[model samples]
Target: MSKVEITTQNNTKKITLSGHFTAMDHDQFRAILDDLQSGEGCTACAVDLEHLEFIDSGGLGMLLLLRDACIKQKLALSLTNAKGDVLRILDIAKFDQLFKVVG
Candidate 1:
Protein backbone atom coordinates (compact mmCIF):
# COMPACT_ATOMS: atom_id res chain seq x y z
CA MET A 1 0.00 0.00 0.00
CA SER A 2 1.02 3.61 -0.48
CA LYS A 3 1.18 6.45 1.96
CA VAL A 4 -0.31 9.76 0.86
CA GLU A 5 0.63 13.10 2.28
CA ILE A 6 -1.27 16.19 1.22
CA THR A 7 -0.47 19.83 1.68
CA THR A 8 -1.75 23.03 0.16
CA GLN A 9 0.12 26.22 -0.53
CA ASN A 10 -0.18 29.12 -2.93
CA ASN A 11 -3.46 27.78 -4.20
CA THR A 12 -1.90 24.46 -5.10
CA LYS A 13 -2.50 21.11 -3.50
CA LYS A 14 0.48 18.79 -3.46
CA ILE A 15 -0.03 15.10 -2.95
CA THR A 16 3.05 13.08 -2.17
CA LEU A 17 2.98 9.36 -2.69
CA SER A 18 5.41 6.88 -1.15
CA GLY A 19 5.77 3.13 -0.91
CA HIS A 20 3.84 0.81 -3.20
CA PHE A 21 0.62 2.13 -4.73
CA THR A 22 -2.12 -0.34 -5.55
CA ALA A 23 -5.75 -1.26 -5.01
CA MET A 24 -5.11 -1.42 -1.31
CA ASP A 25 -4.68 2.33 -1.30
CA HIS A 26 -8.22 3.00 -2.45
CA ASP A 27 -9.50 3.74 1.02
CA GLN A 28 -6.98 6.48 1.56
CA PHE A 29 -7.29 7.78 -1.95
CA ARG A 30 -10.95 8.65 -1.51
CA ALA A 31 -10.05 11.18 1.11
CA ILE A 32 -7.60 12.69 -1.34
CA LEU A 33 -10.26 13.18 -3.98
CA ASP A 34 -12.54 14.70 -1.42
CA ASP A 35 -9.85 17.10 -0.41
CA LEU A 36 -9.30 18.12 -3.99
CA GLN A 37 -12.97 18.65 -4.55
CA SER A 38 -13.23 20.81 -1.48
CA GLY A 39 -10.28 22.98 -2.31
CA GLU A 40 -12.31 25.88 -3.49
CA GLY A 41 -10.49 28.34 -5.73
CA CYS A 42 -7.42 26.15 -5.88
CA THR A 43 -5.49 26.68 -9.05
CA ALA A 44 -3.71 23.34 -9.29
CA CYS A 45 -3.13 19.91 -7.90
CA ALA A 46 0.26 18.25 -8.12
CA VAL A 47 0.88 14.59 -7.49
CA ASP A 48 4.48 14.00 -6.44
CA LEU A 49 5.75 10.53 -7.14
CA GLU A 50 9.38 11.04 -6.30
CA HIS A 51 9.37 8.64 -3.37
CA LEU A 52 6.90 6.18 -4.74
CA GLU A 53 8.57 2.79 -5.15
CA PHE A 54 5.97 1.04 -7.25
CA ILE A 55 2.48 1.37 -8.77
CA ASP A 56 -0.02 -1.06 -10.14
CA SER A 57 -2.87 -0.58 -12.62
CA GLY A 58 -5.21 0.16 -9.75
CA GLY A 59 -3.00 3.02 -8.73
CA LEU A 60 -3.15 4.31 -12.26
CA GLY A 61 -6.92 4.21 -12.08
CA MET A 62 -6.88 6.25 -8.92
CA LEU A 63 -4.80 8.85 -10.67
CA LEU A 64 -7.32 8.95 -13.45
CA LEU A 65 -10.03 9.48 -10.90
CA LEU A 66 -8.06 12.34 -9.49
CA ARG A 67 -7.74 13.77 -12.98
CA ASP A 68 -11.48 13.75 -13.46
CA ALA A 69 -11.98 15.40 -10.11
CA CYS A 70 -9.49 18.08 -11.05
CA ILE A 71 -11.23 18.68 -14.31
CA LYS A 72 -14.55 19.29 -12.66
CA GLN A 73 -12.91 21.59 -10.17
CA LYS A 74 -10.99 23.40 -12.93
CA LEU A 75 -7.70 22.59 -11.29
CA ALA A 76 -4.60 21.96 -13.35
CA LEU A 77 -3.25 18.51 -12.60
CA SER A 78 0.41 17.55 -12.73
CA LEU A 79 2.46 14.48 -11.99
CA THR A 80 5.86 15.43 -10.67
CA ASN A 81 9.26 14.03 -9.73
CA ALA A 82 8.63 10.54 -10.97
CA LYS A 83 11.71 8.37 -11.37
CA GLY A 84 12.95 4.77 -11.48
CA ASP A 85 10.23 2.14 -11.72
CA VAL A 86 7.55 4.70 -11.06
CA LEU A 87 8.67 6.83 -13.97
CA ARG A 88 8.89 3.92 -16.33
CA ILE A 89 5.47 2.69 -15.40
CA LEU A 90 3.97 6.11 -15.95
CA ASP A 91 5.72 6.58 -19.27
CA ILE A 92 4.67 3.15 -20.49
CA ALA A 93 1.17 3.92 -19.41
CA LYS A 94 1.21 7.23 -21.32
CA PHE A 95 0.45 9.26 -18.23
CA ASP A 96 2.46 12.06 -19.74
CA GLN A 97 -0.32 12.47 -22.26
CA LEU A 98 -2.96 12.51 -19.57
CA PHE A 99 -1.27 14.90 -17.13
CA LYS A 100 1.42 17.54 -17.06
CA VAL A 101 4.62 15.81 -15.92
CA VAL A 102 7.40 17.73 -14.23
CA GLY A 103 10.65 16.74 -12.58
Candidate 2:
Protein backbone atom coordinates (compact mmCIF):
# COMPACT_ATOMS: atom_id res chain seq x y z
CA MET A 1 0.00 0.00 0.00
CA SER A 2 2.80 2.41 -0.71
CA LYS A 3 1.07 3.76 -3.79
CA VAL A 4 -2.29 2.86 -5.19
CA GLU A 5 -3.56 3.69 -8.65
CA ILE A 6 -7.08 2.88 -9.67
CA THR A 7 -8.49 2.98 -13.17
CA THR A 8 -11.80 2.06 -14.65
CA GLN A 9 -12.82 1.74 -18.27
CA ASN A 10 -15.54 -0.15 -20.04
CA ASN A 11 -16.90 -1.62 -16.85
CA THR A 12 -13.51 -2.98 -15.82
CA LYS A 13 -11.72 -1.64 -12.77
CA LYS A 14 -8.11 -2.24 -11.90
CA ILE A 15 -6.16 -1.30 -8.83
CA THR A 16 -2.38 -1.25 -8.95
CA LEU A 17 -0.44 -1.32 -5.71
CA SER A 18 3.32 -0.93 -5.30
CA GLY A 19 5.92 -0.90 -2.55
CA HIS A 20 4.92 -2.32 0.81
CA PHE A 21 1.52 -3.45 2.05
CA THR A 22 1.50 -3.33 5.83
CA ALA A 23 -0.14 -1.83 8.89
CA MET A 24 1.14 1.64 8.05
CA ASP A 25 -1.02 1.68 4.96
CA HIS A 26 -4.16 0.33 6.52
CA ASP A 27 -6.19 3.50 6.32
CA GLN A 28 -5.44 4.09 2.67
CA PHE A 29 -6.23 0.52 1.74
CA ARG A 30 -9.43 0.53 3.76
CA ALA A 31 -10.70 3.46 1.77
CA ILE A 32 -10.09 1.60 -1.44
CA LEU A 33 -11.72 -1.49 -0.01
CA ASP A 34 -14.75 0.52 0.98
CA ASP A 35 -15.14 1.85 -2.55
CA LEU A 36 -15.02 -1.64 -3.95
CA GLN A 37 -17.48 -2.93 -1.42
CA SER A 38 -19.95 -0.27 -2.40
CA GLY A 39 -19.74 -1.54 -5.98
CA GLU A 40 -21.77 1.30 -7.40
CA GLY A 41 -19.88 0.77 -10.62
CA CYS A 42 -17.41 -1.71 -12.11
CA THR A 43 -18.28 -5.16 -13.34
CA ALA A 44 -14.81 -6.66 -13.06
CA CYS A 45 -11.81 -5.85 -10.94
CA ALA A 46 -8.18 -6.89 -10.79
CA VAL A 47 -5.43 -6.00 -8.37
CA ASP A 48 -2.08 -5.69 -10.11
CA LEU A 49 0.73 -6.53 -7.72
CA GLU A 50 3.61 -6.93 -10.12
CA HIS A 51 5.51 -4.07 -8.50
CA LEU A 52 4.61 -4.85 -4.90
CA GLU A 53 7.78 -5.10 -2.85
CA PHE A 54 6.54 -6.46 0.45
CA ILE A 55 3.51 -7.59 2.39
CA ASP A 56 2.68 -8.43 6.02
CA SER A 57 -0.14 -9.95 8.03
CA GLY A 58 -2.09 -6.72 7.91
CA GLY A 59 -1.76 -6.64 4.17
CA LEU A 60 -3.03 -10.21 4.00
CA GLY A 61 -6.01 -9.19 6.09
CA MET A 62 -6.80 -6.39 3.67
CA LEU A 63 -6.72 -8.90 0.87
CA LEU A 64 -9.16 -11.16 2.66
CA LEU A 65 -11.43 -8.23 3.23
CA LEU A 66 -11.36 -7.42 -0.45
CA ARG A 67 -12.22 -10.99 -1.34
CA ASP A 68 -15.18 -10.92 0.99
CA ALA A 69 -16.41 -7.63 -0.37
CA CYS A 70 -16.17 -8.82 -3.94
CA ILE A 71 -18.05 -11.99 -3.08
CA LYS A 72 -20.77 -10.08 -1.31
CA GLN A 73 -21.14 -7.77 -4.26
CA LYS A 74 -20.73 -10.56 -6.81
CA LEU A 75 -17.97 -8.77 -8.59
CA ALA A 76 -15.19 -10.56 -10.39
CA LEU A 77 -11.92 -9.90 -8.58
CA SER A 78 -8.44 -11.25 -9.16
CA LEU A 79 -4.81 -10.61 -8.35
CA THR A 80 -2.17 -10.65 -11.04
CA ASN A 81 1.61 -10.64 -11.43
CA ALA A 82 2.47 -11.68 -7.89
CA LYS A 83 6.01 -13.01 -7.40
CA GLY A 84 8.95 -13.18 -5.06
CA ASP A 85 8.12 -12.50 -1.42
CA VAL A 86 4.67 -11.24 -2.28
CA LEU A 87 3.80 -14.50 -3.97
CA ARG A 88 5.35 -16.55 -1.21
CA ILE A 89 3.33 -14.78 1.43
CA LEU A 90 0.10 -15.32 -0.45
CA ASP A 91 0.95 -18.97 -0.94
CA ILE A 92 1.70 -19.40 2.71
CA ALA A 93 -1.68 -17.94 3.50
CA LYS A 94 -3.28 -20.31 1.00
CA PHE A 95 -4.94 -17.34 -0.69
CA ASP A 96 -5.53 -19.42 -3.78
CA GLN A 97 -8.53 -20.85 -1.98
CA LEU A 98 -9.98 -17.37 -1.71
CA PHE A 99 -9.11 -15.45 -4.85
CA LYS A 100 -8.03 -16.05 -8.40
CA VAL A 101 -4.32 -15.23 -8.67
CA VAL A 102 -2.39 -15.22 -11.95
CA GLY A 103 1.22 -14.48 -12.71
* Per-residue accuracy of model 1 over 1-103 as CA lDDT, tens digit each: 8989999989999999999999999989999998887897689999999899999999999999999999999999999999999999999999989999998
lDDT, residue 50, candidate 1: 89
Clashing pairs in 2: none
Q: Which candidate leads in TM-score?
A: 1
C-alpha positional error of residue 78 in candidate 1 after TM-score superposition, expressed in Å: 0.3
lDDT of 1: 0.94
- Would you list the C-alpha lDDT of every candidate in the order shown? 0.94, 0.86
Which ten contiguous residues of candidate 1 have the minimum total lDDT?
A: 33-42
